[model samples]
Target: MGMLCGMAALSLVLGHADARGDAPPPAKKPRLVRAPAAAQPAPAASPEAGLLRGPATVPAHWSRNHCPDSIPEGAAYYIVVKGDTLWDIARRFLGNPYLWPQIWDKNRCITDAHWIYPGDALIIPEVNVVAPGPGGAGAGTEETPAGGGPTGARGPSTPGQILFPSIEETALQCASYVVDGREDESLRLVGSEQGATKVAFGDRDILYLNKGSNAGVKAGDVYTLHHETYAVKHPDSGKAIGLKIEVTGWVRVILVQENTATVMVEQACADIHLGDYLKPFERVQVPLVVEHSRPTRLTPPSGKVVGTVVDMQDDASIAGDRQIVTLNLGTANGIAPGSLFVLYKVMYPSVPTPRIVLGEAVAVAVRDRTTTVRILNSNDAIMNGDKAELQ
Candidate 1:
């Protein structure tokens, strides 16, 4: 009964609405809702896009976003980005965006800071980033600094010139390090060769090395190839052990393979054959500090600790064409900054003398003057000119 009444009331309301519709009712439109605005995109940095207007043969740049506020007037920093823009990042690193171009110009690698994606590393430059003007990268026909060349600017001369102590020309400025591992090699014929043609060993074959290019094998790479030979006593009481061939000699790795490699056959006098095993003929990597192993007691006959000059950062020491090339020495060698000692040359002494009897090595960086030599938290190397001796 309730349902019937409800239906009847609905019909009445519908009928009433239809009767009133004759008064010309218009069409109804649905309301639309507006969406919230999004954040604005960062402004583009207008780094100079022209010729090579930078100092030296090489130049670098801040290849990351910058925070405008953090950047100081003349500080060195690599641009990084997490939630920042070039201007913001610049300000954060350099303290100003007007100095962005100076940083941009010095960092020639950063051609397009916009395209600088995350994870791409950059080499930040030191102070005195010359801009594009008379002292900067401005194109002009005027006098330039001595080391400035045409586009670069040279700083005024100073008195704290630090030059690297002269070393033997033999010890090269090699790209990497070299080691010593030798065991007085010797090769000799085994038995009589009266009629040894096509002997019992003819059944065994040998694998010869055919070295190829690109291995960078510039001589002195030893290859040890071996073959087993078993034999019994002919007409004796005791058994004698036969000697398998253990040949070794320096070779140039010519043909490099995916897994297997080929090397030149340097010594073939021992009647070499086909099936001989080959690999790097390694002796022994003597400890950084080894005891008596050399023919002479003075020498170590093994590996030695080595280091190189990774940086030279003394502005005052860079005058007079003399770069204060710091060495890989210091407290590790029992040196401290300002700790004075006579420089000596590292020489291998003769019979009566011991190896590395120091003679004359130029005094290099002091603790402070040395590159990457710190005397802070843990241990700092002594200043340049400190004595370098072998304990």
Candidate 2:
């Protein structure tokens, strides 16, 4: 009877606790637990990342549309868009368009200020506003001198800006001599500079000409001197195709007479002699365009190996990197200045295919039947007998 009474009392106590909403502390309300924060993804790398330091950043032009006026600190990047320039990026980010060099120095993919293409993600560093001063905008800045400092005009020359000679300069100064021995009735060297009677002459020497005003030649007229080398023979028939000529030198007429004139040797590729011949000079000029890679979809054009390395510009027997060489192929064979050719050495020309590619060259000057080429690159020493085909 006591046990029953105790159980009844306990039941009554539990029922009262439930009515007061206190059952086992309501399961502790799940402790209102919170979950951990999620991890953020890292930024994607750029295709030109190898050429740069830190992360790739974009120009401020991108922020004009999408970002706030003030950018956060630390590494940033931007996708390149059409019409965006380094100058514009500098002005937008650094508050100075002349400071584009700072961004350029930070990016190696930007080989040229004028050549950045769309889709390139440029790096944007922190704003480093520099006051205009003498000299220029500072190192890595463009040549925009403000106040009294000499701009790049009179300052020390910037390296890499003039590393290679222009095509016009090379053509005028470094063209090879074409040997022309065939007798021409009208064109023949009469005498040396100042009539010194020297057997061989060179640059800056004055010469006496046989034809002047009567032959439509006048003072200040430029002429090319050449000599007949030999007639090129057909490999199959041993028949002569054409007479190959050699360039002797160039002359500028200073004084003119009815049948005689005083000419000055402007440039001499070889020794100017009493028997050299002359014709009106044709100005040759072509801008140098360095190719980073071979053209795609456009395979190298097919052409015959028609020339030999008659001579080297530096008088070296074997030509290598950056050496100048003369080839028999020229405008007459559809070769022009700036034309690229692949050098090859085939033991037997009778074979249908080129045996091996030795190197590459670029034409700096094109004459009637010859061209002056500079070795762009080479694997083997370019010898005199190595053949070259259009690339």
Candidate 3:
């Protein structure tokens, strides 16, 4: 009985010690079982992430809140890349695939729409689009005006409102003639619009000429009207340089006859008389651009002042703004309509400089031996003896 009690007491003591939590940890998994590799963090976004987006996709750079109704003028451009097509480019930039020809027309370098190399920059012209808005129309959604634009911003048209001169106005404003000693020339003004009764004529008047089909005159052909007024004498030499031909008007052949042609006076700067001469008209070159590229002074090859302002349309001794003046230089001296020139006065008799800048002139009509210049602007009065140098 004593031995049994001792064994029970020892077992109870061991159970109490286990309940006190003095146990060892379990063993880890064996070496045969492998673990997974750690996951990598994603790469940072690229700096050009917005630029590389496909053309068909709306650019990420566009503001979501404020889309435009039309592409503003001179706003956008595209750099050509390999495998780019005009169709895709138009759709991407102009928002319409059918407008691909617009792109082709603008980019002259694209000789063939099918073949385009990288690195060519293309201009994206302004285009109208129906931008979605709260009212289904937006800020630039107005209809074009009747006379000018879709926005109705052109207002109304009025007579005499046009400040800039028209082609006919600019052409007919001056006169150009080459006097070659044809006093009894084959072509001459036979009579005025009022039969042979009228002595003088004006613009838009009918006139009779002495030559027609037999002289190879066509119905649409234009002619210049002039008469040798006086002989232009050289200032120093006292010898005759060229004849001073007074340009009276111009005419367009209308009716044809065996030896006569009826013509309408297109313009008459002076009174047109019966004895005025007629010569074939010359077309005007040189575009009337908003700005002309001209040298500050005369350039070489045409450096020297080769001509002088011999006459004025108004018959005034001095010419001011927008006055017409005649120059000795013509097509023979490489002068053309739209040719720029600087008018300067000689302070001293022999010295060309310091050039007294009289003004600037533009050649509106160039003839064989003389040119018609319109004084564009002048700081002072432009005289007849003023010098002209090509720009």
Candidate 4:
């Protein structure tokens, strides 16, 4: 009886399996299909990529509508809007449109002076205003004597209410001058890493310097890159006084080896090239002073010292206002930087002719026997060999 019961149970289980044999195959498991990742957009090229001094990052407090209430010490903020220009902004805030470069110097994010976006933020530098009192506004004030005084004598001063801007930093940095002696050639721009496709280098270009740690060069050392253009001859004596050097650019040492150093072009006023000489960097600042009024009537020579305009930087036959010219008079003639000169023309030394006044210039850089002057104003074209009298 037990065997028969077991046989019956096994047959029932087999019958149930046979009934489900034809039943639908097991359901398929769904496969996951991921969507393609969204494509990332490329970064826009900066218009001022190689011109900027440092890496640019958008300011955290930047806004198009309003500037932040809190600002950096000694600095104010300005939010750019459409149709805004650096020139206009400078005139509106600094009271001088020519001071736009100062505004540009303060804001590193601005790449091009021509294009400032509406959302961009700018830093307005504080202008030093003189207060009314001695040693402040009218301390050094002097009147233009009916008869001109000696060269060392002060020229006429502008009113205390007027303010003049200093020389543009770029002009002062790239200024070419006549040197009494050859610049030290110990350091030179030997080569560059740009291979051979490029002959001219500009701002931020990597370059190799011939000088290194052995020559007192170290990381962070700054130098002025320049090249001698030609020898300057005295207009009257007809003798070689010095060589004229054209500043190509500036560089900073990044790595120093035994006999070589790696440098980067910091500020480029012109194209830099191999074989350019280097000198210890100098910081030049042309101070602000009361501008002298242009002399309208003929003024007698100061008789302190007389010189001639030897050459001009541009080599143009004629120079007008705000041009750079080389002068034969220098420190030896009691000519110092910021000294004023009255430009004139005397056709004949023997014959008495009217001292034709041309323009005025100020000594910017002075050596023992050579000086560089920037023509402040000119009613007529100033040329080489024009007479410059100390004022």
Candidate 5:
């Protein structure tokens, strides 16, 4: 009985110890299971991966914005780059720079040929490909004539080619000319609606004339507005021959009262001022002619008649290419419109020196003793008193 009681006491002590949370047996470690390869998440792609693909795989938005998929037949799309002009484009594609007007005609969006911006798409008209000159500058590719020196040398226009209008019609209409001091001053511009505030008038302005129904003025009658500038003297004789009459603008009578007439300004080349005289309006016909190459050599003078550049338009003393100048020779010297003249300078009359070829000009308006010429080309600045001879 003593042994049994001892064993019972020992067992109770062990139970009490276990209940008090003594150190327990260690737990088994968990095994990490590998996921299948197919179940793994895919790796992310690089940002530049799309660029590795060809242009065909490019995004639709980018390709559409950059270029057209296809252009029209017989025409090419030219994305205007910096430093591009209609003249340069025409010469590059159409073989002639003067054909720039054709391009302007085709692209009505280009209101002014003088202005073109980069990135603006232009339609290039395909024409005969002129053989490019040396350095591919698109110089005149037409073969030189028998006696003409080379392709780029100055000479007459090539035969069997079309002639283009060299001068604009408006330029011809506004050109100044000379007349004998015999113009009738009976009809004149007297006042305007804005005459009190404005000293000059332009197109679409209303004006009043001094003459009316009593002086034979009628509605729908067009008159040229002119004013006497100064007397043009002969360069050689220094004698006054004719008056330099400047065409300020044109006017058309709208209503005629007993002693006054109401008129509207049709075109204004210069400022239309009060006291401007009026004459019967004559339509000026500008000629269509080939622009001849400038003469480079010491070509013999035609001896038709020699003259001097007395004055330039707008009181300018120096003139360059495309500037208007007045010559002392005119109808009395057999000078006529469209006539070509070679401008030369005799540096030393005493020394036997060849006349230096300065430039060339074309007569646009001819009067009795004076002619107005448009300088076609000038190697140097042409000034008053420069010598000119018919070519």
Candidate 6:
């Protein structure tokens, strides 16, 4: 017909140029109405707003919430007197009066270790011990009373402040302020040496008392140098001589160094042997710490001396001197009103300190407990219907 209408007008102009290149069909993806990853709302773990999401063992810088630095640069004190007792002063300076709460948590200035008051003055902190792996920097951190933790918003048990690889931030010598324990005669010996996990001198190690100045020990006394799993017998043919030993080690005087002192050794558990034996458990019993001062000028009672001295005097009341007297149990032992009694003469049966030079009174003096004393003048005319021991 005219070439079939000229191929139908070139097939209708190639179907209108293939519908203008056909690209408008992709505009239909709006079906993704995925407004349902379960309807949103689920992202609140630990931005710290009450933190506590999971796995944080104690890593908020080690968590103590920060409060440290209360006098740690090498501390040691011990004064109190008159029959002193906090389990006998933590069994003579922390050999274990059950540790007296580690000296009442290192003294925090003593809240109450039986009211400690006799002239006060008692701190013995210092436990800087850190000997773990790579550089070792651990000590002090153990607080937890900021208030309302558990995410309520009172946090800070120990969170930040590590600096001590060079060693100098040392606090914890029982927290200072004095009060908890260590005053039945003070001079210390605490310890360190990382507790000798295989201590050696021939192998090239030689550190028997890391820093307690070899018993002149002071600076918070707290030794270990451990390895006493028991069973070394021989106190009287008990048997069993050699099984596992480099011998004893258990110190407790935080900081004291006229030579070299600084100990912690809480408990080495195992491995420690380089001539071990850094002993002494605290018995220096009253060398100085008489800080109960309050008599700014009230000095009275030069002759009022209450009774209790049933005979025992060696000499020491030097403000004047007029010795001679005796009584049994007058004034019920309270005998205050100027209190001062020394009269003691048993001759023997008082000395027991020997755990490696006991707190060292020059290595060993308080031995037979030393005796002989005098001075007693208060007892309503002092009488003794029982044993008679007053002066």
**Top TM-score hit:** 4
How displaced is residue 6 in candidate 6, in Å? 99
lDDT per residue for candidate 5 within 148-174, as digits (tens), equals 111111222333444444355566677
For all candidates in order, the CA lDDT equals: 0.27, 0.52, 0.52, 0.62, 0.60, 0.26
After TM-score superposition, what is the CA distance of residue 292 in candidate 6 from its true location, in Å? 46
Per-residue lDDT of model 3, residues 1-391, tens digit only = 1111111111111113223232211112111111112211211222242122212322333111222223333234565454455555554554434334455555544433444444444555443211111111111101111121111011111222211221233234335444545555579998766876778998788888888899998897778788877676534445455666676767888899998999988777688899788877543322231232333334332333346777776457888776777776666555555556778777896765566666677776766767777776777888877777655
TM-score of each: 0.19, 0.45, 0.48, 0.60, 0.58, 0.16
Clashes of each: 58, 18, 5, 0, 0, 67
Model 5: clashing residue pairs?
none
Model 3 earns a TM-score of 0.48
What lDDT, from 0 to 1, does candidate 2 have? 0.52
Candidate 1 residue-wise lDDT, 1-391, digit = tens: 1111110111112113323232222112111111112211222222331111112222232334332323333333443333323333333344332223334444445434333433323233322211111222212111111222122122211222221112111111110111122222222112212234533222122222433234333333445444433321211123221222233222334444443344544433244444444455432110000011112224241211122232222322221121233434333332222221112222332445433312212222223212122111111222222322211
Ranking of candidates on TM-score, top first = 4, 5, 3, 2, 1, 6
| Candidate 2 lDDT score at position 184 | 61
lDDT of 5 at 212: 90
Q: Write the per-residue lDDT of candidate 4 for residues 74-178, one digit (tens) a residue.
A: 334565555566655655565544435556656645533444555565666654322111221111101122223334422222233343432444676688888
RMSD of each: 32.1, 32.2, 35.7, 26.9, 33.4, 33.5
lDDT of 1: 0.27
Q: Distance from true position, residue 72, model 1, in Å? A: 18
Model 3: lDDT of residue 208 = 85
- lDDT tens digits, residue span 1-391, model 6: 1111110111112113213332122111111111111211222333333212222222222211232323332344444344454334443443222223334455545433334444343444322211111211111101111221111011111222121111001111111111112222223222325453543322112243434355356554444332323332222234332222222334344545556654434433234444354544331111110112121112222222222222211211221122222222222232211122322222232674211100000000111111111221222221111111111
TM-score of 1: 0.19
Write the residue-wise lDDT of candidate 2 on 1-391 in tens digits: 1111110111112112223332122111111111112211222334353223343334443121232333234445555455555655554454434334456655545533444554565666553321111222111111111221221111111212221222334233435444334546486688865565477888788889888789988887778887765555433345343555567768888999999998888777777788788887653332233333532223343433345565565456788876777776555455555556677677787777635667777776766656678776787788776766654
